[model samples]
Each structure stands twice: as C-alpha cells, then as structure tokens.
Target: MELRHLRYFVAVAEECHFGRAAARLHVTQSTLSTQVKALEREVGGPVFVRTSRRVELTEAGELLLVEARRTLAQADRALDVARQSVRGETGVVRIGFSGIAVLAGTLAADLHHFHRAHPRVELHVTELPPAAQVQGLRDGTLDIGYSPDNGLGDVGDLVVGRGVRTTLSIAVRHDHSLASAASVAPADLEGENLVVYAADEDDDSVLDRLGAEQRARVHRVTGTLGALVLASAGVGVAVVPAATERVGLPDIVYRPLRDMEADVEVVTLSRPDELGGPVRAFVRSWDRAGRLTQS
Candidate 1:
C-alpha cells in the first residue's frame, strides 16, 4: 500500500481515537476515517475494534502496527540519506594524486580542508602517476586528481588547474662538493650523478635544461622518497621540487636551482561536467591560487 496509508494507519493506531488522530494529523475526522478504511481494505483485515465507549486494536492490527512503524522509520531514513547525498553532505569522492603533489603538501592541505568541512564524505585517495590519474579521470574511476600533468594535449574537455607553483632544488649530502653552494645551476651538476623522478612527461623537469653530458649522467628513480634515500646514501644528488626542503634529511642540504627560470607546477585534473555533488564540493574546497607557495 502507499506510505501515506501506513502513516495514517500509524497515527490512528497511536492515538486510538479517530477524532484525536484527525486532530494530530490536521485532517478532518471524516477524511481520517476514510483513509483508515482504505488501509483496512488494502491489508484485508479490520485494524481497529470500535466500541461506543472505547477503541481497541484487533490481533491483526497489532502485527500491522509493529511492521508499519518499522517500515515508516526505514522509509524516513532512506529519504534523509537521499536528501543528504543531493546536498553534498554524504557520498564518496575518489581522488588520485602524483608524488610531487604529496611532497608539495598541496594534496594534504586540500584533503584536510575538505574533510573538516564534509566529514561524512568518504575520500578514496590513491598515489597514481599523472598518466594513470589522467586515465582514471577519463574512464570515470576518479572524481578528482592532483598531478604534474599539464594538459599538453589529448585531455579532451578535462579541466586542468594549477595545484602548485615551486622551484626545483638539489638535495645533496653534507660532504658533497655542491653542498656549500647557496644556489645551484645545471652547470654545477656537470660531473655529479643526478637523481630525478621518472614521470609520464618527457621534458617536464630540470633534465630538460641540463647539458647532454649531465643529462647522460641522470639516474631516474620512480619514487620521490626513493630519490632522497639514494641521495642520503650519496648515490646521487637528488633533484627534487623545492618543497622537499620540509622533508630534508640531516645529511641532505637543499639548494635552489638559479638558472631554471620556469616555476614547476603540479596541476589538478577533473572532468568538466561529470563530477558528483560531493566531488564538486570537495574540489571547491581547494584555495587553488595559494597552493604550495610556502610549502
């Protein structure tokens, strides 16, 4: 039967008086009596035993009352959940990120802000390469992403926004020859082996500015932290984003690269029109203009 029928049945059952139930429901006693009669026909039983002086429930009415109350409670909860979802109050937001996004603290800061504001929204974060993040966003597995992938081409209506603006730095051991230098240059790393993150883009990093000989000496590491660990062991001086200074090891000294003019940017990626309510709210939580500036 209709939920309204159950609701009317519950009101009559609770109040046990048609006049009182009508008053509680803000309906005329005649309308309340008509609706209750319709409910009895739908359920094929007499729900109430009417007496001149009193009203009491039939055995069938007692069972229907218990089930009716439970069903109404469940229906109310379902409506509340649907409302909350539509309002961006509860739902899942899947986010993907690249290594530099974490090191730059852009991902963490944005996550914290979103979580504090929408505590009921589930966050599913994965450390994906820029290519994977791009793929996920396009294929509908990810709602939002942070990566160093600048949409050079093939992005197809995906919105790319700046997530970080920082410079590259050299993380070297204390005893390394370039450690004492206040600032470094491509030329300064001429003889030393360099540690760089292996990324989806070809020339997106300091490797593009290095001379052929220094470029030849490059040791590409996949993990950002792996590059630092190797640098701590003197395998090679780590070439990392300037934000790495916050995570500097005791043996590692970071120096800014003076000649690399273009500031490195980690960009955020998302589909234009496919974002869900909670995902859209989570994306808006980021203060994009101020990302990674101090970090």
Candidate 2:
C-alpha cells in the first residue's frame, strides 16, 4: 500500500473517531472515510469497526499501525541523510600526501581543520610520492593530493592550487664548513657530497644542474627524516625545504640557499569535475584559511 494510505490509517486508528481524525488531517469526514475504506480494501480487511458511539481498531489495524510508524521513521532518516550529504556534512574524502607535507605539519593541520568542521565525514589519508599521488588521482583512487611543486606546475587535467610555499635549504652537520657560512649557493655545492630528498622529482633538476663530477657524489633518498638523519651523521648535505628548520635536529643545521627563489610548494591537487561535495568543501576550507591559492 502507498505511504499515504498508511498515514491515513494511522491517524484514524489513533483518534478512534473518523470525524476527529479528518479534522486533524485537514480533510472532510466524508473524504477521510472514503480514503480509509480504500485503505481497508488494499489491506484485504477491515482496519476499524465503527459503532454509533465510537470507533475501535480491528486486530490487523493494531499490527499495521506499529509497522507503519517504524517505516515512516526510517523514511525520515533517509531524507535527513540525503540532505546532509548534499550539504557536505557527510561522505568520504581520500587524500594522498608526500613526506614534506608531513615534515611541515601541513597535512596534519589540514586534517584537523576539516575533521573539526565535518566530524561525520570520513577522511582517508595516505602518504605517497608525487608521482604516485598524481597517478592515484587520475585512476580515481584518491580524491585529493598534497604534492611538492616539482613539475606539477601545470597539469592539464587536474586542478592545482599553490599551497605552503617554502624556500630550499641545505642541512649540514655543525662541523661542516658551509654550516658556518652566511648562506649556501648552488655554486657552493661544488665539492660537497649531496643527499637529496626526491620529494617532487626536483632532486633530478638539482642533479642535472650539477657537474658530472658532482653528480657522482649525489645520493638520493625519498624520506625527509632519512635525509636529515644522514646529514646529521655528516653523510652529505641534505637539500630540504626551509620549513625543516622546525625539525630542530641538534647536529643538523639548515642554511638557506642564496639567490634561490621559493623552491618548494605543497600543492593541493584535485579532479576538477569529479570531486564530491565534501571533497570540494574540504578544499574550500583550506582556501579560506589562506593555506591555498587556487589557480
């Protein structure tokens, strides 16, 4: 039977008086009677036994009334969930990030901001390299990506936002000669053994800029802490984002790169049209916090 039929049956069953039920339901007594009669036929039995003094529910009416209320309650909940989803109050957002984002505490901060605002929404966070993050987004496995600006300055398919721009610095042991210098330049890397974190493939560009002899001394590592740990032991100069100064490793001192522009940016990436409302809201939240500049 239609939900309206159940609703009408419920009203009449509760009031126990057809006339009063019709008044409560904003319908005339004759119309209410006709509707109830239609409901009785649909149910293949009498829902009410009417007498001159009052109306009493049949056994089937009592059972149907209980089930009808439960069904109505479930329908209400379904409507509420649908509305909440549309408003971005509930859903899932999958995010992929790199080591630098974690080292800078940017990924954690963004997660806290979004979770506080939408507690019911599920956030799945993953740590991945820049290439993996890009691939995941393209393959529909990830909704958002926090990547370094190695070569993702312009991706034709994905929407990119500049976020957490930082300068490059070289971490060195306290006893290293460049550690005491005012600043280290690209030229200053000449004889130093290089420990580069390939955060966004920028380490490749750094290596390409070096001479053949210097390239032979370059060591590549993927993790931020791994590079810094090596630098602390005097393995080599660790090239990292200047924000790494926050790390406060005693033996490792970060010296800014002279004449170098802002060398690293934690970029925010998303599929332009495929993003759900919650994911877009998450991005907008960061934009409002001034953490991202959308291009």
Candidate 3:
C-alpha cells in the first residue's frame, strides 16, 4: 500500500522468519508482523503462513514480493537521481549561443573545460541570434546564452557576465583589394560595401567607430557567419569578430582592423537571480578556469 510497507514486506519475504526480518529491518518482531498483516489486509489476502518452526509465503505473498522488490529498487534509484540533480552532477543544461561565441578565446576554452569536468551534465546547446537568445532567457527556454553583448538593448533584467573579448576583423574574398594588407585601417574602408548583422543595434555597434557608412554600402544578414559567407562570395566585405579567422572558408581572408579602439564583448546571459544547480556549476567552472580575462 505504501513504500514503507513494501520495504517491510520485502525484508520479511527475504528472511522468511519474523525475528530475522525484524532484525534486518531494525524493528521489533511484533512491529514487522503487524505491518505485514496490515499490508495483507489492505491487499485483501494473507501474505504469510506461520507455524512453530517455519514461516512460508502464500501465493499472494510471492507475487507481492516480486513486485515490492522491483518497486523499492526503482524508488531507491529515483532518490539517487534526485540527489544527483541537486548536486549538479547530472541534468540537462540548455545553453544557447551564436556560432561565433565559442569560436576563439576563453569562452571556447571554458566550454571544453566544463564539458570535460561535468560529463554527466547534458549540455543541450543551440545556435541562436542575440535577440533570440535574449528572448529564450526571458521566456525560460534557455538556461544560459552566449551572444554579442552589443545589440542586447535593455537586457538589464538578465544577469550578463563576461564571456569573451574579441577584436574586430575584416572578412573579404581572397582576391579582393586590401585582402593582402597585413592589417586594414578603418580609414581605408571608406567607400567599401560592407556586410553587417540584421539588427540595427548590431549595425550601429563597435564597427560604427570606423565610420564605414559615411562612404560605404551596408548589407545586413541575420548572423555573423552569414555575413562572412557573403563576404567570401564577394557580396560585400564583412566586419566580423576575430573568430571568423578559424572558420576556414574558401576564398575568404581575415584582416585585422587597425585603429578600432572598441572590442566586441561577447557575453553570457541568464536570469537575473542565482541559477539552477547545473547552470550554476557550469558558470562556476567557467570562472574557475580563469576565462574571464578581456582579450
């Protein structure tokens, strides 16, 4: 009838003697016998037959024994899993990010460290735009988000933390003019057509310090990688985070943007309060790995 009754029934069924079952259960013989009798009454059957020398199980008792053992084992396992969750040793952590967030620096290394250390924690990762990531966090669909911190306007309700600091770079076709330059100065891109993010906030980001729009045409795409892909096809030169250098796109060249005083602070966002166990553990692991440096 109850888990405790099942446990008592299991102990009694295993030992087959009132005294031994009571000792195994750390209870008095009378207590064990009374509990089992109560269980038998609840089940509408007798579970045991006792003589002066032996205790034998009824057919009902045999069936209840098998089921009771299984139920108790499952209950024990359930408790173990619950405890593990509370300890942050196991559970799913939904992490949202743009493709470029984990590409270059400390944020990338932090992910590796967290994964290696908490192998049992399921890292359910998704690629989302910064606006979508912000929405996901607010809507409770995502536990953590990595996005360009620039365009997340009025995200003050989210707990934004240092993720990675990245320098700006120009992604151009291999044969495009200035691709061979060691580093391209902002002034040199005066009249060039440029690829930027779909969001106006992103368009008006740190890249605007270059004053590209005063003389250049701007094309907008939904993602940083999309901008680079267009740049590779000579659609336009893309102002991208330095991580684009590692993407290995054919016919694409990355040149550092010189005289750009501002860096893109790719940051992590979460709910404004202390997070759940798994997410908190992951954030702590990131902090412990010393990945908070602004590069």
Candidate 4:
C-alpha cells in the first residue's frame, strides 16, 4: 500500500476510534473510514473489528502497524543522511599529497580542523609522487591534491585552488662552505653536486632550467627524505622548499635561495561551480595556515 494508506492505518490504530482518528488526521470520519477500508482491501485482510462501543485491531492490523512505523522511520533517516551529504557534512574526500616537507603537515592540520567541525565526513589521505598526484586527480581516484605547481598544468577539466609561494632553500651538509653563507644564490651552485627530485615526463621547465652544466652535477633522488639523507651524508647538496627545514635533519643546514621562487599549490578535479561547503572550508583553513606561516 502507499504511504498515506500506511499513515491512515497507523493513526486509526493509535486512536482506536474512527471519529477521533479522522479528527487527529484532519480528515472527515467517513473519508477516513473509506481510506482505511481501501487499505485493508489492498492488504487482503481486515485491519480492525468494530463494535458499537469501540474498535480493536486484528492480529494482521497489529503487525502492519509495527512494520509501517519502522518503514517510515527508516525512510526519514535515509532522507536526513542524503541531505547531510549534499551539504558536505557527511561523505568521503580523497586527498593526495607529494613532498611531505612542503604540504603534509599543513594538510594534516586542515584535516583535523575539518574533522572536528564535521565528524561525520571521512577524509582519506594518500602520499604519492607529484606526477602520481596529478594522474590520480585526473583519473578520479583523488578528489584533491597538494603539490608543487610545476606538476599541474592547464588540464582543461581540473580546478586549481588558491596557491601560496614558499621560498626554495638550499640543503647542505653543516660543514659545507655554502652552509655558512647567509643565503646562497643560484650562481653559488655552479659546480656543486646537487641532489634533485626525479623528473617526470611533464617536468620540462625544471629540466630546462638546469642546463647541461648543472645537469652534469645533478643526482636525482626518489623522494624528499632521500634527498635530505644524501645531503646529510655529504653526497651532494639539495634545493628544497624552505618548509623542508621543518622535517628536522640535524646534520643538514638550510639556507634560503636568494633568487629562486617556488610555490605549493592545492589542486582539485572538482569543478569551481560545484565546490561544496566542506571544500570551501578546507580552502579557507589552508589560506589561514599560509598567512600564519608568512607572518
């Protein structure tokens, strides 16, 4: 039977009097009686037995009332959950990151804040290489990413969120000559053995910037920590975001790169037109964190 039929049955069952049930349901007594009869016919059984003095439920009526109440309650709960998801209060957001030193902690902090505010929402984080983050975002495996801007190009369908610039710094062994300098210029790295992030096919600018002479001295490392470890062991110096110092390697000293500029950008496959409340909240938190760090 339809929902209205179930509701009419419930009301009549609860009130026990056709006239009173109709009044409670804002319907006439005859209308209520006819609807209840229709419902009984649809169910293939009588729902109530009537006497001149009172009305009482049959066994079938009792069972239908119990089940009808449960069904209505479940339907209401499902609607509430769907609404929450639409409001961005409950659902899953898959976030990808690369280069732990630059965006990992900031992303973690924003996630903690978002979780506190919307505990029903699930945040899934993955650490991937810069190239992998881009691929994941494009392929719908990741909803958002945090990575250096160099990795993300003008992918027609993707949206890039507000980005913040963080200075590139030189990571050198504490005993290295350049480690003693207040700041090292690009020219200072002329003949120095340099450790760098492994190039992806999309990274032509980085490759081009380090021309033949610089490329000759370059040693590619698999990850941020590997570059730091190599620098610490005196295998070579590395150029990393200033944030890298936060990872805390005692044997490695970080010196600002006097002329280089690098930025860590937040990327998303989600459309600008479709950004939900949670995504907006996260972007705000990220912006605040960048301001705090800058100040």
Best by lDDT: 2
Top candidate on TM-score is 3
After superposing candidate 1, which stretches have Cα over 4 Å from the reference?
19-35, 52-55, 149-153, 201-206, 209-216, 287-295
User: Relative to the unseen true structure, what is the C-alpha lDDT of residue 43 in candidate 1, on a scale of 0 to 100?
Assistant: 78
Give lDDT per model, in order. 0.78, 0.81, 0.79, 0.71
lDDT (Cα, tens digit) per residue for candidate 1, span 187-279: 788778888765554543556644436566677765677788889899998888778788857798888888656456778777776548897
Per-residue lDDT of candidate 2, residues 208-286 (tens digit): 4333256778777766788899999999999888877888888888898876554787888888765487887887887
> What tens-digit string does per-residue lDDT give for candidate 3 at 175-293?
99988899998888878888866444344664456666553377766577788889988988888888767888889999999876866777877775545778878767756755433
Instruction: Please provide, for model 4 over 226-275, each residue's C-alpha lDDT reduced to its tens digit, 9 standing for 90 to 100.
Output: 88999999988887666777878888899987665443343333334435
In candidate 2, how many clashes are counted?
Answer: 0
- Displacement of residue 54 (Cα, Å) in model 4 is 3.4
Q: What is the lDDT of residue 200 in candidate 4?
A: 62
Give Cα distance to truth, residue 245, candidate 1, Å: 1.2
Clashes of 1: 0
Write down the TM-score of every candidate: 0.83, 0.82, 0.89, 0.80
Candidate 4, after superposition: displacement of residue 64 in Å? 2.1
List the candidate 2 regions with Cα displacement exceeding 4 Å: 19-43, 52-54, 103-105, 199-203, 206-213, 287-295
Candidate 2 has a TM-score of: 0.82
Arranged by lDDT with the best first, the candidates are 2, 3, 1, 4
